[model samples]
Target: MLVTAFAANKTPPPSPTTTVNHPETRQIHLKPINRRRILTSLAATITPFFAPRLEVNYEESNLVTATFLPSADARGLFQMPPPRLSNRYFLVRAGESEYESMGIINTNPVAKTSMDNGLSKIGKIQTVKAALKLKEMGACDNNCWIWPSITQRAYQAAEIIAAINVVNRSNVVPEYSFLDARGLGAYEGRPLQSVSEIYASDVVSQNVKPPPISDGTPNESVADVFVRVTQLMSILETQYSEDTVIIVSPDSDNLTILQAGLVGLDLRRHSELYFEPGEVRYFDPSSIPKYKQPASALYKCLNPPSCT
Candidate 1:
């Protein structure tokens, strides 16, 4: 009678497991808990996406004077408008230098140019490997240009890259303060770790310009660096197209910040894009993550297709 009553009950039995069968194959059983575990595992593996942060400062802003702009859509872009670029761009952080090996910080324009502060032996080898990689990638198959910082280590790396690739020696143009390492003010000649304080502040505000020295050394903020890098980008995008351009920097900060600006990232968090010494990254505008289109006032159009 008890079994008869159980059978008459309308309640359905809970499924302990479900069997999935492949045609002419073995049947695999999956428990409900197993399904939940699989879903949880997938969720753990997936990385959550974060929207680009825009922190604008009108005081440091300047107008972009270029007449021609690249055709890229500028919606949601910050610092500068979406660049119209036909040229392939590469960012190369200079190889380790003598000063770097010694754990010294040197951004003084005069002192950094000295030969002793130039690329160490390992640095030269690293630069040569990078050039070979570029050759393998056929980056210099056409007109290639290497724009390097005036700092000796970066210039040396540029020369090495030029020698190994198809680019001519003359094409290795030396850029001035624009590509220089971030200035650490009184922290100059201090230990490399001392600059962490400045970066900590940069995380708080992009407008935090470092105090200046009496000797005329640069004491700049991340925004100050952005201003110069934006100017450089204006020139490059305006003058070159259908060419390969390699920009070499003596330190990671310049290239990282430049990349941050290039991708319309918040300049204050530029350190998130830091490059290892001798690291090389190819820049592609189409591959960047997109955000909701922002108003044109969000950025200064460095080189706009139409400023209207």
Candidate 2:
């Protein structure tokens, strides 16, 4: 009786059935992205990523700076270079170590390779001494490339030209690397007051593109953004033996991108570092450990739906 009751309560199997799929299904297409006129639009962030093989010195010259500063060389209220020029040549792609340094100072417009901001003579002497001292400490090695930010090529040319003079006068100095400033051909433009802002607005804040301007402003170009991020990453991933310094602009987007990459904030919220114009800042990779995920650098989640 119990067995019969259990069988009666059990579920029954139904007869065979046929299923059908729609013949006219819809296909989804993603709208095209307008790459140009976007602020801080790094190459990797946009389409057509960089070449697989990034030569260490594409437009770079060998350069050096110090790992640590001697009290005398570490002068200045904030130990900053003057308002315009980090003229010394330094390696673009360094390594991720405490001993390696990526110095960022400043760059300004120049009419020729031998010009500077002409803003400060005292600043030149101080930076010259500091850059050389860094070379001894194993930073740029005295042969570094003057950074060519869109707005500061001329300024960089002036600073490195000044540093080259110091390398010549000093008792022991590496020959200024890469004889030319790579032609300050692309330095004429309006300044980008906040490179960091562009990234934050577009990548982080989900904002509109800046209005296209033809005037001399640093109209964010895809190639230029790619160059800055790649050069800085090369320094972080492969080059350098210690903490690095950068003679950079107070508000450079390139510098901000470097800082963001280092801190592993791409997938969370965009992070940035703020330095006063001509202010000196020590960038230690140790401060922000590398991301555990090997591809975080490439993934660089700039616009995660939930990322800050």
Tens digit of lDDT per residue, candidate 2, span 26-45?
22222234456244456546
Candidate 2 matches the true fold with a TM-score of 0.35
lDDT scores of the candidates, listed in order: 0.74, 0.34
Clashes of each: 3, 53
Q: Estimate the TM-score of every prediction.
A: 0.67, 0.35
- Model 2, residue 173: displacement in angstroms? 15
Off by over 4 Å in 2: 1-203, 206-208, 216-218, 221-227, 231-251, 267-271, 280-283, 289-308
Predict model 1's lDDT versus the native. 0.74
Candidate 1 residue-wise lDDT, 1-308, digit = tens: 01111222244335554445546444444434456767787777652222233445657877543232223433223236444565789999989889888888888777778987699888888888888877887878887999999899999899888888868888888998688888778777788887788888877677786667866578888878887887888778767778889999998888877877776666666787788888888987555553233375443333321111
* Highest TM-score model number: 1
Mark the 10 consecutive residues where model 1 has the least summed lDDT: 1-10
Every model: Cα RMSD to truth = 24.3, 24.8
